[model samples]
Target chain A: MNFQPYRSPSTGRPVRAVLFDTFGTVVDWRTGVAREVAAFAAAHGHTLDADAFADHWRALYQPAMDAIRSGQRGFTKLDTLHRENLDAALRHHGINPDQFSRETLEELNKSWHRLPPWPDSVEGLAAIRRHYIVGPLSNGNTSLLLDMARDAGLPWDVIIGSDMTGTYKPLPQAYLRTAEFLDLEPGEVMLAAAHNSDLQAAREAGLATAFVARPTEHGPGQAVDLAPEGDWNLVASSIPGLADRLGA
Target chain B: MNFQPYRSPSTGRPVRAVLFDTFGTVVDWRTGVAREVAAFAAAHGHTLDADAFADHWRALYQPAMDAIRSGQRGFTKLDTLHRENLDAALRHHGINPDQFSRETLEELNKSWHRLPPWPDSVEGLAAIRRHYIVGPLSNGNTSLLLDMARDAGLPWDVIIGSDMTGTYKPLPQAYLRTAEFLDLEPGEVMLAAAHNSDLQAAREAGLATAFVARPTEHGPGQAVDLAPEGDWNLVASSIPGLADRLGA
Candidate 1:
């Protein structure tokens, strides 16, 4: 299992808590959406390209945030961003918006609130909890993440979402604000996720980082983000593997 | 198991969450401190009155904060407040500050980080969480409540401490600020606590209120607060009782 003791780069504090990124990291968004969308469309008398729709909606996610962040557009939630893409996908599929009321579209946007957790997530987190404080350091917003935790039975000691800080991750302040809220120095925290970019940002902000591989996150045609790209504090194939190294 | 529903005075929206006063409501602070002080006095070789000391400390508590709220003192955390009280208590007990190193004194103050939860707190909160968002909404800051939750296994779905609003309860602004943070209307939330005073303030601020009786909280000679004094939405003998009436 390669159970080697790792150290934080900036501070000598043994890592106390591990904060996880939710979507595509602890929760499988792609597969969860594909399955949910297929069923949702089937209930309405049609079969949709669930995977393609998922990819299309996710593709619009970053640019939509970019517009909001850059002040090119008014601030809108991820739910609104997802609905815009949903409308576009329906139009592209030759379906009228009249087919579904604004209320149904709003409810469908809540699919983000019900993503399936990664198979190793729940038990592996339970394992990790024996040693450290384990919770989400997600950008998913507070209410959405809270509903997800309740529905998925994710036992978290605390929930730290961007809504609490009014900023998104990869931004240094977002990571630092999270540590401040926990009354711990940034170096005492470890950001754990399957994304290399998030790890790079955390490392730059003086927090230890752990990388877990989830290659299928970007979908079957995904070419990039195959593995860890930086000298992360720890790397593991799955959540349980990470727990094993941490001696949980 | 009669689950009679009480409509909100303002909105009639079902209570989706119950915010708490934290310290004396969910935790048995008197018993918690009495044990800590007894252990400290025994270890250091002196007969100290931990129970009397707890009373003195809590007595000084609101006055210190009232000083801050009234602009007599600057912003200070509960940890700092406890430290000052510990210093005063040591002087009263004839313990030389120089006898203990600064590190030892600091550790003594940190005893608050490990408070004992009330007997029904954990299981009752777990049952209530099955139906609503349950968490601490105390004058204690977020870090303090979060640490207490970890130490005591308080099953909270979210945390809304005074640190977020930069104010304390008894002020209508404190209750209003919590509703603002949750994106919930005031009447959609309920303030549940063992203290009728807390429930009264919340009710005045337009939130639904539930009073859970904690008769033994103040220990022997605790005659004042054994029952609800006002007309609360739901009054129960304990947290589990409250959960049952709320349909958990």
Candidate 2:
């Protein structure tokens, strides 16, 4: 595939770092979560539509974060949010919350930390890291990101997440604070995400933006975010494609 | 040389993460700084005792941090502190600040970010990382630690430093906050350092501690911290020695 390097028309400063959106961009969370949930359900002699359970649990992610982002609740780690959402999802699915031991439930909640990286994530990140600082700028808390990195062998130069900034994606504070913490101008950091909305927010925060399509991020027949929504600085189909375009 | 693992007498919990003290424990900052300063002076046709200059600059480190730790000043990144100390050192050494351009001075101040790790730092960290998450919990800021890790090829699974906590070491907050952020009990995390004072503070904070003696951390003929002053959970002569004792 032919790849074209991106240049910021506004500042033209070279990109020094690539801050990624973690979930669908780097890891196949939907598949990973569904697999773990199915295994857990089988072990506990419970019948569950694991795929639906995974989707339902993820559907609660944004609302949980919205509570903190909208100031309705104080900042809480994504791990806490996941546990609460997991319990609610279990209850909603007609599974008695008491059916699983506390330790089993806690282990299941950490499914996020056990996610495997997308096929191209590790190699592409290694390529990018040779030329630029690369890390996740995601809603996952510091521990979550760190655990995922270690589990998946993701070579992140740094880890930046909403937990550090106490705000969720699309919030100006998240993008701005990430760049500030890295001691880089927003223009010097590019947000490479599978979600157009995340790139849009990053662009508004003065960061360079790239869109990498994850056509089946929500599994087969997934709709939305399959194409770039705006005139992103770079658009690619995979992380390696992004790496090539970035000359990494 | 023979090595023995030291077990914690207090909690006896297995270690999950090893937080390092970066400057003296991981990197030879004194030799690195002196070498860079000497090179810069020769390039600028200046004559100076680089060894004494490095020592004098380091001598100001504790007092500068003390100001912030004592609440006399707001939290400041170590980069800022290093730059301020660099200017003071330059002036004190009878060099006109104008002799070098702003960029030159700025580059020189970043010598800290380019310090060479001790011979065992890379290998030892890699070994420890196999069994436990290993990262620096130091006074250095995030960017500084990131740069040094990249330059020195340190395979840190995570990076946690005073920048994240807005406090310096020997303070309970630094150790406590790091554990809180990692979502681990203090007893589950070990603070590995070359200074007994740091290990003492970690112990008091209810965290496990390991003392790795950097006998020449302050350069040859240095006094104090040459031996373990307290019954730290583990004590070793080098990072690799520490790793061996920890069974990593």
Candidate 3:
């Protein structure tokens, strides 16, 4: 890939750090989660629509965070939130949570930790890391991100979890506080995400933004974030392409 | 080197994460800062005792952090603290801060970020990383640690900065909060340091401890932390030796 150095238009400075939104951006979470669900159902001697099951579980993600973002509840790590949603997801599938041992349920909950990265994630991140600090600015807890990085071979220079920021994405603190943690001006940091909404929030929070399209993130019926909704600083179809554009 | 797997005597669990004290432990801060001081002095046509200057600056480290630890001051990042101490050190050496430009002073203050790692730091860390997560749990702030890791080729899986914990080392939170961030029990995390006082505090906080001696850290006349003072879980002469004892 040809290299083109990236500079933030907002500050006219070369980017120093590039953070990523992990789920559905760097990793194919839907497919990975569905694969786990299929194995889980087969082991339990039950039939489940794995794809729909994965979607159903993910659907609860926002509402759970919405409660925290709205200050209706205190901040909580995504792992705990995912566990609670897992029970709800089970009941929605007409299965009782009590049927599974605590150990089994806990293992199933860890599907997020074993997610497979997109084909280009590891190589692209390794490339970008040669020139810039690379890490995940994800809603995942520190352990979840660490496990995924170890399992998926994501060559992250660092890991920034929502637990570290005490908040989730779309909140200004999540982006701004992360920049502070790195001792960087917001403009020196770029957030590359597949979701247009995440990019929009990041831009508003003073970070440079890059939109990486993941049209199949929702398994072909994806209706949102298909293209950059705002004038993102950079736009690319894949993580490798983003790295190329960044001259890494 | 013979390999021996380490298990915490307190919990009998295999260590999952190994964090180290960066200054004077993983890196020779005194030599590094002195090297930069000599260069800066030569550039400015001034003669200074570089080694004594380094020791004088370092002598102020604990007193600065103690003020914050005692709640006499709010938590501050090490960069700012280091910059403040640099001015004091300059005045103590009969040099005025006004003799240098703001940029020059700022660059000199970053000498800590460019410290040279010990011969065993990179290889030992990479070996240990194959089996466990590795990082620096130093009083250095996030940016300082990130800069040093990049410059020294330190393969950190994560960075737990003093700023991240809102406190400095020897404080219980510095040790406990780091374990909490990695979702590991204190017993599952080990702190490797050249200082027995640091290991002693970590042990009191329920963490496993390893003493890696840097007997010349304070120049050949170093008298403190020459040997393990407490019954640390593991003791080695160097980081690679520490890795051998961990069976990595």
Candidate 4:
């Protein structure tokens, strides 16, 4: 076992915590959500593009967070936002929302809470955890993240939810406050993410950045986040590959 | 394995989170700190009673937290308060504060972060964690709790530090805010603590409470907290006993 510290390229100092972007970086949200949505559709006697339905729901994520980031709305849990987005996605698919009971809607909304992790995520995080504090630095709420961790077998040392920070990704405080909560300087906390924009924002917040690519996060023709668009501190094809790069 | 949900005695609702008090509850702070203090004293050529010194340091804990609970002081990390208290304890022992270097004082303050868990803490927490969310809901800061969890092998699903809540224990917000963080109803969160005052505060805040006795926490002749002092939801002689009662 290598006992040497993992140094942050940004500060030339040891990285104490390695936080992750959960949705696409650590978990295969597209596949997980689509599977749940397909099951929901089958049970409800509806036939539609479940994968596209998942995409439609995810497409609303940024705008809802942008509302809070722009100060147009107070901080809300991602669970609540997901519920609202679910309604919009149902309407977009020409499905009558009134047919669904509140309990059913809530269970569907929690599809995010039980998303399956990427094949490499669990082992990669375990390896990294042996060397540093490891956890999700996602926009998911604490409860949502906790449920996902329990369901997906993600061994997190801590959970930093958007509700805990009262902000979402791409916002500076989303990265900075999480670092402050861990009593670490931003540079000593590395953000291992799959999105270039997320990594860019984290870097701007003075956090060390690593880009882990999920080429199929948006399915076969996924165009965005296909490569490292910025000069991230590290880049890898998979989380375990990133772990290897960190010598974890 | 038991699949039945653990119901909170307060509201007869299923409890989802089981948070703990760290010092003297999960970990043996008196013995742990005394060991470190004894080693420090020996290395520095001092002949102080180490256990007494640990008592002196711990005796200042509540008063320091009370200052914050009363709003006489703004939110401060327990680490900072511990450092301040260390200075007073040093002076009380007739030791020159200037004799210790900043590095030495910092290392001494971190003794709290390396506390050894009580015999049942690790296994009991593991058992309880398999059934419910488990973590520290202590006056210690997040980094302190994280370090202690790592060192003590306390299997936690989340960590609710005083800094995370921005208030010390016994404050209404301290208990309420932690519940809010987990998106759990107050009754859905149970606080298992060694201190009656903490359990009382949690109960008043509408959280279910459990008392685990640590009769020797303050050493022989420890009179306080030897038995359950309030109408706690559960009472046990050890953490494993508490886990057994919860059917975990």
Candidate 5:
């Protein structure tokens, strides 16, 4: 095992903690959400394109967060955002909201919490955790991240999410506040994400960045973020590959 | 195993999370602080009553928090409070401020982060965590709790502390905010504490309460809270015993 410290590109400081972008980087949300939707639709005697539904629901993620990030909407947790987006998607797809009971809607909304980890996620996280503090650095609410951690058996030393900052990713406060809460400098913490845009924002916020490609994060036809677009501190094909690069 | 749900006294709801009063309930801070102080003083070629010093330092805790609770002072994290109190204690004990370098003083202040958990703490917490969500409901700052957990191998699912709420315990906001952050009703969360005052305040805030006897939390001559004072939901001799009572 490589015991050498992983150095940051800009500051040249040894990385202390590794924070992850949860949705596409750590968990296979696309597959998990589509599978759950398929099962729910089948059980309800409804015939719908579950995959398209999952894609449409996820597409609203950024716009919902954008409203709050731009101060056009008040601060609301991601769970609430998910529920609103789900309702819109159901209406858009010609599914009557009244067809599903409140309990069923609530369960369906929790698909984010029930996301399965990527194949290498659990083992890779365990490896990196042996060397550095590991936790999510996503826009997900505290409760959602906690529930997902429990469900996926992810070993996290801490949970740092946008809920704690009242803002979403690409916002400096989200990255800066996570470092402050963890009692570390922004340069000392590295944001390991599967998306280049996340790493770009993290870099701009003065945090070290690592890119792990998730070519199918947006499903089979996913085109963007298929490879590192910028000079990230580290780039790997999978989470375990990143762990290997870090000598974890 | 009982496999029975633990019900709250007032709300009659099944408990979902067990939040601990960390300092004295799960860890023996008095002993740990005394030991570290003795070692530091000895190394610095000074003779002092380490136990008295520990007690004196702890005695300032409530007043410091009271200042914030009453709005006399703005919110400050516990680590900052510890540093300010440490400086005052140094002068009170006749230690020249110049005698110790800044690094040494800073290291000494971190003694709180290295506290030793009670003998049953690790095992008991592990057992209960298997059946319920377990974490510290502490006034200690997030960094302090994280450091202690890493140092002592305390298995915690989440770290809920005063830092998150910007207030101290026995305050309704402290208890209420924790439940809000965890996405649970107050009655679904139980405050497992060794002190009657903490449990009483939590109970009054609509949370379930569990009393565990830590007769020596204040050291050998401890007098208060040696027995359960009120009609708590569950009272046990130790954390493991509490787990058994809760059918965890």
Candidate 6:
């Protein structure tokens, strides 16, 4: 069996395009959004379910992203998806329908863009960016990804969000689409992710995988993808370290 | 007459997306490609008419881009467009058909990808990237743009080349389609360039215009677009200064 390795020719290194798993890789949503939710609740003088709401919102991600992938629904941006989730959250909180204006809903939806970058994220991406073209192959739609980039000062060479592919990550189509968008073969792109499952999937599609452990991606004590499993092409402790290892 | 200002919120400081005029704005196609043509001819031990070929090939751009835009031809990428031009040039140059293989011709077509970046391009873009979602909205196809970005180290957040929009710049739909593809309102995107005609058309169509004077865009002794002609939002001596003025 011939195994195809995704490597860059510049340094005889594996991978040219480092496609990131955005939600948990670059930014921490749990704590960031939880605090905002709590504060928004507090400002409203209401005791509401912040954690549950956050979990509900995150839970809807796949199903919503799947709608497009399955061809059940037309393409929709993440902002609209977040809006759909927020409207239900508001209803669950028993808030009066007329209490909040469309402006309020818009601002709340923007919270996703405000999530704080991981301690190593900004510095890490900057370092990787010097040598390789780093972009997010995220489930986040283009608008959401673009907004997040603006809010967090993420210096991405391109935005390979799901909106472009009309499919979510873990699908070979999604990975292939990123490579195609970058005008590279699948073997030329490396999926630099914090999740083992994402790596496993990209590997199956012949994309090189680099694991940057985000032990706290799901929050402390979560322990998901705490280590690389199977045979990943490269593994690094952090994004900057990954950059160094990749000759960035 | 009240002049409507061009600004896109998707890009906060100015517009979310700033479309560029490719031929002269992003790449110095005439000089760049002519230089490559000269080198290729020398390597092949043939007297290639570099200047004649460059002019003849460029003359095919508008009709080709327009054909796609007008649906006279289905969406053909710039690679295909360039290859078609090469075929025509090869016939005109009376080059022997057996002299080059199909793959060789394809590789030669990629000469456009290696176009040299203008002196201030990288730094100016680095500065501009601080604020805008920089990408070329040229008649060049996505794959061509992608390779160009990688080869020249151009930092583009998206590659809205001709193939994606099914048209070329200077066409209202090309600029309009770019904003729509990014899911941005026309008012939220800016068309930044050195061409007055491009800026004028963009301004007319509700896109903000930023003019970065490329005094030698038409090569030395060029007298066009010496200064801002249509009251563009910002006029600067260089791309970096444009970045600074935009406070990117």
Stretches of model 2 off by over 4 angstroms after superposition: A1-6, B1-7
lDDT of 6 by residue, B1-248 (tens): 34223344423343666666666777777788788888878878889778777777777766777787777887777788888888888778887646788987887788888888888887888777656677887777776777788788787777776655656667788888778767777877877788888888787777887888877765677787898887778788777877776666
* Model 2 chain A poorest 10 in a row by lDDT: A1-10
Better of 2 and 6 by DockQ: 2
Q: Sort the predicted structures by lDDT, highest score first.
A: 3, 4, 5, 2, 1, 6
Q: Candidate 3, residues A1-248: lDDT per residue as tens digits?
A: 44345788786877899999999999999999999999999999988999999999999999999999999999999999999999999999998999999999999999999999999889889988988999998999999999999999999988878999999999999999999999888989999999988998999998999999999999988898899999999999988899888888
Compute the lDDT of residue B123 as modeled in candidate 2.
91
Encode model 5's per-residue lDDT on A1-248: one tens digit a residue.
Answer: 66776888696888889999999999999899999989988998888888899999999999999999999998899999999899998888888878889999999999999999989999999999888888899999888999999999999888865667778988899999888888889999999999888999999999999999999988889989998999999999988898998878
DockQ of the candidate models in sequence: 0.64, 0.74, 0.84, 0.88, 0.74, 0.49
The CAPRI category of model 6 is acceptable
DockQ of candidate 1, scored on C-alphas against the true complex (2 decimals)? 0.64
Candidates' TM-scores?
Answer: 0.90, 0.96, 0.97, 0.98, 0.97, 0.85
Between the candidate structures 3 and 6, which one is better when assessed by lDDT? Answer: 3
Task: Quote the lDDT for B136 in model 4.
Answer: 93
lDDT (tens digit, per residue) of candidate 3 on B1-248? 34444788876887899999999899999999999999998998888999999999999999999999999999998999999999999999888989799999999999999999988889989988888889898999999999999999999999988988899989999999999999999999999999999998899998999999999999999989999999999999988898889888
Task: List interface RMSDs for the candidates, in order.
Answer: 1.4, 0.9, 0.7, 0.8, 0.8, 2.4
What TM-score would you give candidate 5 relative to the actual structure? 0.97
Query: Model 3 misses residue A209 by how many Å?
Result: 1.0
lDDT of 3 at A182: 94
Question: What's the CA error at residue B91 for candidate 2, in Å?
Answer: 1.2
Fnat scores for every prediction: 0.60, 0.67, 0.83, 0.93, 0.57, 0.50
lDDT of 1 by residue, A115-219 (tens): 998899999899888778888887777778887898888888887667666667777877998888788888889999888888889988989899988888878
- Per-residue lDDT value at A189 in model 4: 94
lDDT of 5 by residue, B1-248 (tens): 55656887687898889999998999999999999999998998888899999999999989999999999999899999998899888788888767888888889999999999999999899988887888899999888998899889999988866877778999999999888888999999999999999999999999999999999988899999999999998999899999898887
Clash pairs, candidate 1, are none
